[model samples]
Each structure stands twice: as structure tokens, then as C-alpha cells.
Target: MDNQRRGFPKRCQCGEPVVLKTSTTAKNPGRLFHGCPFGRDGNWYHTFKWTDTSMVEEIEDLIEKVENIDGAAMTLQKGVNACESQIDTLAMETRVHLGVVEKEVEEMKMQLRSLKNIVGFVMVMVLFFMCMY
Candidate 1:
């Protein structure tokens, strides 16, 4: 018999379909079983069955698998967050290094301009001396 059929009783003593309810206790957390709704009023004309131990065990196993998957997802999220943080830090460092390089390039351009002016001045002086000679 299937776990669902075994776990769920077909009919109550009152000729109604048994309602499924989950056990909330520590020993049977999330365990699915059938109960007679009419039995809630302390009537003795109700049926009960907890012999579907395989179904409860299967449910517990599935719950554990889900919890493991959730844990893995959390771990993966943390790794992604760490990678993002590292990327941001590296980007900031790269920006700072680029700024320094840009400043150095500008200074080199200024020095080259000064050197060109000095060379032009020396050439003019040489030409003037040659013209006199």
C-alpha cells in the first residue's frame, strides 16, 4: 500500500472522511496522520491509527533534506556576498591607482612642455650668434 493510503484512514466512525492533521509535538513534528473531527468532543465513537510509521519516517527524511538544502543555499549566499565585497574593494583600489597614474601623466606632460621651451630658447640663442658671426 502507498504511504498516503496507509497514513490516511479512509472513513471515521461517523461515516465521514477522516481529516488529516499534523503532529506538533517534539517526537512527531510534522508527522501527517488521520483523525476524526467528531472525536474532538470526547466521543468514543471515533477511529484512530498511528501505525503508519513508514510514512512519518519518510516525511521526517524529506524535512531533513529540505533543511540541508536551505543550509547550503545560505552558505552559497554568504560566498556570493564575500565575492561582491572583494570586487568592490578591488575596484576602489584600482580607481585610486588610476588616479595616481593620471596625476603622474599630467606632471610628465608639463615637464615635456618646459623642456620644449628650453630647447627653443637655446636654438634661438645659437641662431642669433651665428648671424652675428
Candidate 2:
């Protein structure tokens, strides 16, 4: 039986349509099989595959497909986790940079205030010198 074979048997190797029939013997009673009517005619070469075997092969194939899908999903989840980690790192870097920029802006404001004071004193001295003259 081929594990890759999917679904039930539709036709036998003898080019005859398969039929589902139950066994009625002491060795294996009430067992189901998919076989051709010609297969039961006391022929040496006949198709007599068990329905249970085909079902088992089909189930095996479905299990393999499910396992492959699960593996792909795990890979995608790992990629998503990596992207989230990178985003967190960038966010932290941006916060640190913003803090540095704000401090620089405050320092510039203080320097401007000092320059204004110096200019006001220079203007007063010029006025006093002119009054003395």
C-alpha cells in the first residue's frame, strides 16, 4: 500500500471498478474491503485491498500535511518575535535621543539670556559716557 495514496480506492489494477463488501468468515468476520467483483472469482491475480489500509494511508498523509503547516507557522512566529524586539530597541533609542535634544535646547535658551544681559550693560555704559562728555 502506498502511503502517498489519498482517498479510498476507486478502481482496481484489473481495470474494474472497486466495490465495498464485508467479509463473512471465521478468520476475519465482518471486516470490510474494497475489491473488484472479478477478484472473488477464484483468480490468482486479483485486487483485494482492505478498506482499513487505504484509510490508514490517507490519515498518514493528512498528518504529514498538518505537521508541515505547524512547522511553517512556528517559523513565521519567530520572525514576528524578532521584529517586535527590534521595534522595542528603536523606541528606547529614540527616547534617549529626544532627552539629549531637549537638554541642548535648554542650554541654548540660557546662553541667549546671558547675551541679552551683556548687551544691556554695554548700552548703559555708552549712555553714561555720552552724558559725561
lDDT of 2 by residue, 3-116 (tens): 333557787778888899898878879999887888864674767767897788778888999999999999999999999999999999999999999999999999999999
- Looking at candidate 2, the ten consecutive residues that score lowest on lDDT are 1-10
Every candidate's CA RMSD: 9.0, 4.8
What is the per-residue lDDT of model 1 for residues 1-133, given as tens digits with 9 covering 90 to 100? 5545444467887898777777777998887657777765356578555546646666776898899999999999999999999999999999999999999999999999999999999999999999999
User: What lDDT score is found at residue 26 in candidate 1?
Assistant: 90
Off by over 4 Å in 2: 1-5, 9-50, 119-133
Clashes of 2: 0
Candidate 2 pairs with clashing backbones: none
- TM for every model, in the order presented, reads 0.56, 0.58
In angstroms, how far off is 109's CA in candidate 1? Answer: 1.0
